[model samples]
Target: MAHADWSDPTPAAGWTIAHQIAHLAAADTNVLIAVRTPEAFDAVLKRTEAAGSRHADLEAAAGAAKPRSVLLDEWRSGRAEVAAALRDLPTEHGFPWYGSQLTATLMAPLRLMEVWAHGQDVFDAVCAARRPTDRLRQIATLGVIGRELSFHAAELPLTTEPFRVELAGSDGRTWTWGPADAEQRVEGGALDFCLRVTRRRYPAETDLTAVGGDAQAWLDNARVFL
Candidate 1:
């Protein structure tokens, strides 16, 4: 599968399967560097920015230079290394991310979210269907937590009032956040909520329903990742 169809473009912004894997591999490498040698990670960021190079551009260039086998091996090995580094770190220890610092625990979930989201792109490229998993609970939780950040990103006023989030998990369990009787509420499948917050799917494309002004506003401008 890897050798025969590496160049096939996916539905995700028309990125090839190799490009999707390359992005994950590159990101995992950066996380490993951030955990082990923060200065090196910072240097990479500075150098990339100085050269006017986006991370996507760098990932594509690197992927294009390597064989499909090499890229897959790197992605597998790099992710293992990142997992090990995160496990070895103290729970309270924090490391630099794109702009902010995140503890090992926080970083781990973000990594999972990236892999799952990008995995969907790869699966779609190969005409494969992936059933949703309970791991989306982590993503849905992150989306709810990022409500304020989303508002800030959209250049909208932050609502101080809390909004309830109720999502049905893939396993049929309900995940609820915020007040039980809040006037503003968002209710839907966990996958839809995660996809919506990640900007993978527009609000209109999902079955998620937003009630009240604040909840509707959040649904319109949700972004779980930077």
Candidate 2:
């Protein structure tokens, strides 16, 4: 893409295409820090806390100010560092993250969802098409796992009521969660479900079907990220 192409606006409020990629790079760096050293992670956390809610926007803007090639290279470097750190993480340990903690196993899918969700914004902004990948299963899995967290974030009461989710995969297969006989059911294409789960796309914009009010409300507030 041309340098000017980086200025393209995405669906995320107040974020240009460059900002989206920059956010990923910053997030990758934070993940690397968290995985490698809890002490360094806490220092980074203090810096972000001082910025209040603007920390993410500020980080993205800083990276977005760099040249496209520089930004891309930095992102690549940070991603590789995070990948290695995650692989080397001890099995019995979890890392501090945004006032919570996550094991390497869970953190990996969360990062994947973050990248894919932001990548979707870029694709939508440029009107580019992307083929659905098998990796979407990981995202959907994260969505399923994060349902309770999202519900709490949305101020919805926690309910143990199980909800079934059925997705038609791009690879000509059906991926499902919960019991087949569950009353609350969500059905949709895997891509659509992934998009909605990340809040990159609304339920109405996708082919998702919610069989119960609770299920519909879950879709309305779906978000895999903190």
lDDT of 1 by residue, 24-69 (tens): 9988988988899987888867866776746576666677568987
lDDT of 2: 0.88
Stretches of candidate 1 exceeding 4 Å from the true structure: 1-4, 51-53
Q: Which portions of model 2 show Cα errors greater than 4 Å?
A: 1-4
> Model 1: which residue pairs collide?
none
Model 2 RMSD vs true structure:
1.5
| Candidate 2 per-residue lDDT over residues 77-144, each given as its tens digit | 99888888888888657888988898888888888889888998998888888899989999998888
Scanning candidate 2 in windows of ten residues, the lowest lDDT window is 1-10
The candidate maximizing lDDT is 2
Candidate 1: lDDT of 118? 84
lDDT of each: 0.86, 0.88
